[model samples]
Target: MELDDLVEELRARADSARVSQERLGSLLDAVIAVSSDLELAEVLRRIVVAACELVDATYGALGVLGPSGEELVEFVTHGITEEQRAAIGPLPRGHGLLGMVIASPRAQRVPNIGQHPDSYGFPPNHPPMTSFLGAPVRIRDQVFGNLYLTDKRSAPEFSGDDEAVLSALAAAAGVAIENARLYEHSRTQQLWGEVLGDATQALLEGAAQEVVLADVTDAVCRLARADACFVALRQGSDVVVAAASGEGDPAEAPGEVLREPRIRAAMLGPAHIEPGAEGGTRAMLPLALGESPLGVLVAEWAREEPTDHVPHLELLGRSLAVSLGAASARTDRARSELLEDRDRIARDMHDNVIQRLFATGMSLQSAAPMSTPEVRAKLDRAVDELDAAISDIRHTIFALHRVPGGRPLSAEIATVCGDAAVTLGFSPELRMTGPLADVPEDVAAELLAVVREALSNAARHAAASMVNVVVEVADDVSVVVTDDGRGLPEGVSRSGLGNLARRAEGRGGSFSVEPGDGAGTRVHWRVPLASGDGPGT
Candidate 1:
């Protein structure tokens, strides 16, 4: 017991302290590595691998719980090759011993996992293992999943130090998992903002509803990395597919999804996610503006794809609902303004133009009786023309006061021709066919303008009685006006005919004026229904 013995003891103690320090440093390094990654899947994978290496275990895994908190939705593993995983067959659900550890919410250490009373035995082709340790991973107060280690390399049992190290690693993993989720959530929110911004801008800029809906669907599909996305709006008692974008045939998605009860249920409650027929996941979110239901947004993705961003998808649906509501309000405002303007113009015509025309007609009639024979004939013609002008002004007032509703285009054209009959002294025969109700507003306006112009010209210049107006509305709309009267003079200039020709040509259509079968002039105007041009064209 001298200086030599004392120095030897000190050296042994120093060596032991150095070894403990190195082990602690290794554990710290593993913890750091686990916390570095921001991706949730990568973080979970790193945790499993680091936990296995820290505890000197031959196999390790991290099982993510499903929404029910009982089943394993995802299983990330370390120390197993792709072939080994394939051989192991499907991943283990939380059953038997795995369920026991998950339910307990604490660390579990077993010398031999096989000998445990709750063991369910491994599946076919699964590697044999002895000894087991598990720790529940918690993000805040919620248990996110569990970390598992089997077959401790240095000992038959997982020592207390190994259990402590794994528990600490699991705790660190939970924080890392939460951080990764927040990062992902923030990024998803940013993407959703961009999508909503685009939609709002499009609607504000007066983009068509169909175009806005398509843009929203495309943006959501891209964000969800989905195969297809669609917006279905409620029409009457049934839901109709409004707009869709994706890889699959759009026609296929609507029929399959609209048939699901969950989609209908979603309108009243929260969004629902279900397995799709084509080995994918389908998420349906109800789009509403306050208590009013607008439609549903459906998203489809591969079967194994992560749906953690579903909340963001719902946000997109809500944003789209708001945009739709705004667009509808804007349209209503515009229509109201138009109606108000029409009412004002109608009042002016009745109060001023019609009264003045009637007075002028009376003055001409009074002058007709006092003239000589030849002059009397000319004065009588002037009186007749003035009476016709008054009649036309009254008809214009009636048209202006008419409510703009779902009245058929054919009926409107007939009304115009009937008014023209008073001026021309005989009714024009009218015939119409095809889907006139589906005609766009601007096209209808132009068509009506052409009809009025043709009728006015016939009344003013034609010296015959019978007239025929035929309107056909199919994939293209055509209007023919024929009058049995004097044909166009050789040297006369017709500016109205030029305007009508320009109108037809601007809309990628045609207009023609030719002599009728025997006499009179035939005016033909045709325009394609799908031409993008409007009244200006």
Candidate 2:
């Protein structure tokens, strides 16, 4: 061979070798970028760009197979113009060349795509393509997605070298995708660990039930990336929103998500959905542990493609379920303790302080007849002791009933109001509304007690001639009482507001007092229901 031809051949080989090294470097960079960032979209974009550059192709695209392996969840293309992408339109699902990769789960190279009988000609607006290369992305037995490239830069066609590089990149992408997912999962678990710690600390601090619910909702929202985070108690036909972090009214959440139909089908297990509705995307995490469902944590997404955080979100769902079980158990215990405390305080006042005060009052009244200096002094001492006992009783009752933590509505209210009537000379006008037949014991107690307080205040302080009490049932049950007398007497201290405000403020209900036109005072109190068994649990 001539000297000139030999040097040209050596230089040509050198240039090809240099190009090969660059492709390998690009592949390594893509993998490293994926490892550094767990964001799925960014990782996917990098993967496509790297494959295309490695093969020196004009275009590259990646499509992720759906959970069912029947539909294409997403398709991302690199090096395609904005107008070109518009021409591509809504990504084709399972058809044409894309389906071949899915069905075979193997690599394929088409040097002359148009000449092949299976080419399935592209629309007129679609870009011209001559060469095509695609490889499956699989991790272990799970088929993750597909990596594809088209129209090699070489005028002739895609070389075997091009095929080899793309295949290598696909394999590398699979590993990176797996690693990124695992890293995200680990971080998510760590975050949930923090939430568990916070819940524990709040429980120890004796935080109120509402406080606990709020803390949980905030954590769930942050970790899940949901548009709305809600802690809902499962009901038959409706799931009441117990706590929420975003737009929808959890209190009024549709029952469909938590309905018996869904739960029974799901059987207290974790479930999800992208049921796109009202420009919102929703996913439900069943708050269950073992064989029971305590509640559900629902979240909405404002964007399509849940690819970003689905794996991490699943972890959040499981952790939230465990946390919910613990919270539910804590709630039950707190309520039991509250009821026991209320009863103890009520009994103490009735048996010890009330009796002592009455006895002392009697002794003082009897001694008053003597009208002697010594007797008068003794009488005065007895009266002072009696007053102290009454004050002690009042303090004990208020402290026990106004704990402001987790307690059943029915029991707490009954104890406070019933005691007031016995000690304050007025019986509350109790009313029952709604499906009282199946009302929860705790809820009933709270509502009834609210009535008792309003009545006690009206009779004892309002100086009303008559008191009317009514409880009604309907879409919403309400208890309202009216008295004909002076309204809140001037000089009434804030200490007395408990009797005035306890009903509304205590139970998440509205409490209002307005003048009854010509005669007296009217107190209104309302509480939303919490029985999750409205239709199902």
lDDT of 1 by residue, 1-537 (tens): 699999999999999899778778978999899888898788989999999989899999999998889889899998889999998899999997799888898999999988999998999888899999999999999999999899988888898888888888888888999999999889878888988998888897789777888888888778788888888887656677778888756454443336556666677677778787677888888989888888788888876454676878877888788888898788778778877898899888878887887787678778877889898877766665665565456545555644555357777898889988998998999999898877776677667767876787788777768889999988899999999999666633465566667878888899888889889989999999986565433
Prediction 1 global C-alpha lDDT? 0.82
**TM-score per candidate:** 0.68, 0.58
Q: How many clashing pairs per prediction, in order?
A: 0, 15
lDDT of 1 at 77: 90
Please give me the total number of clashing residue pairs in predicted model 1. Answer: 0
Off by over 4 Å in 2: 1-40, 141-143, 192-229, 234-239, 245-294, 298-537
